[model samples]
Target: MATSKSKTSLREDLTCAICFELFKEPVMLGCMHHFCRRCIVSYWKSVRSPVTCPQCRQEFPNKCCFQTNYLVANLVEKVRASSSPASVKYLEKELNDCLESQCSMKDAYISMIRKDKDKMEKIKKTGAELQGRVHNDFQALHHFLQVEEEAMIEELKREQEEMLQGLERHLEALQVAIRDVEKNINILRQTAGSTDQSVLVELPKLNSRPISIDI
Candidate 1:
């Protein structure tokens, strides 16, 4: 393979830069640049002196500065003879194989990119769904807490009202008992100087009456 590539490179080197073809009647300029003899002559006729090499642009004194390069001419002839129909077919097959491999690689890269894009879309969709579910879950939790709070507060209020009512009833009973005690003390003050036997009987009746209070 390396030998074949070297021969191909050598053949390319023997091609004329001006005509882009295998060198015919190859000639070398003073600058060592090569071209076909007729190609350089025609190129020089189109330009003014001092003439310049087509490839390097190196100036020459005159067209006479160019001379036939017999060695390059012989190399070009040998390269032409070596390029048989079979070799041309082999080169074509190699080019087609390279093109097919490049196309397959391109397809593989495109498939990978497509798969990655799909995965990205899936990730985004799943994330959005999860976020929605989280939001809904939190909202439900908040609602439950709110309901529990309201219920607890309402229960506390009812219990407090019941306790206050019980206390008020107890206070009213204590007030009535105090009024009865004051009435008995007034009676005792009025009857004390007389020293009546009937007052002693009334004292027993007053003692028998009871004031009942419930917590």
Candidate 2:
């Protein structure tokens, strides 16, 4: 295994500052800023006179002032080859971990779906029970209203019949009084026409009785 510091150092040495790639046909300048041979040649060709390093800008005599860094090139190739095996092993482990995570999530999703289904069933059952209770309550209320209405109607009828009976008794008493008055008028007319003196002197007696209402 490589320590983090060593890995960082190796990565810095293996990479080229000019093209920012892994060194290809590497070369070194007097400034010690390593670059690819072709990259440095192309960069220096852009400027006239003494060429400067792309990294530190240390002036060189001209474009033809660099030497191949053979030791760095050999080290880069070895490090790249060795890190390849480690990269392959890490990728394999990562793939296996991703597969396990996916399976666990799938199971969780299934369990959540089942729980939601149960809750929905319970809710539906409760809704049905509530509906029945509402209907029953309204049915009882309607029955109570109907019974009260009938009882009230019966009471009204009884009161109306009693009032009618009292009125009939009053009418009968008035008829009897009217008849007696007419009879008395006939007797007075006969007395004025010189009927028997004794009969005229003895006037008819009148009797009246008030009707009674039982309420």
Best by lDDT: 1
Q: Cα deviation of 145 in candidate 1 (Å)?
A: 3.0
Which one wins on TM-score? 1
lDDT of each: 0.88, 0.83
Model 1 lDDT, residue 101, Cα: 100
How many clashing residue pairs are found in candidate 2?
A: 0
lDDT of 2 at 28: 90
What TM-score would each prediction reach against the true structure?
A: 0.55, 0.52
TM-score of decoy 2: 0.52
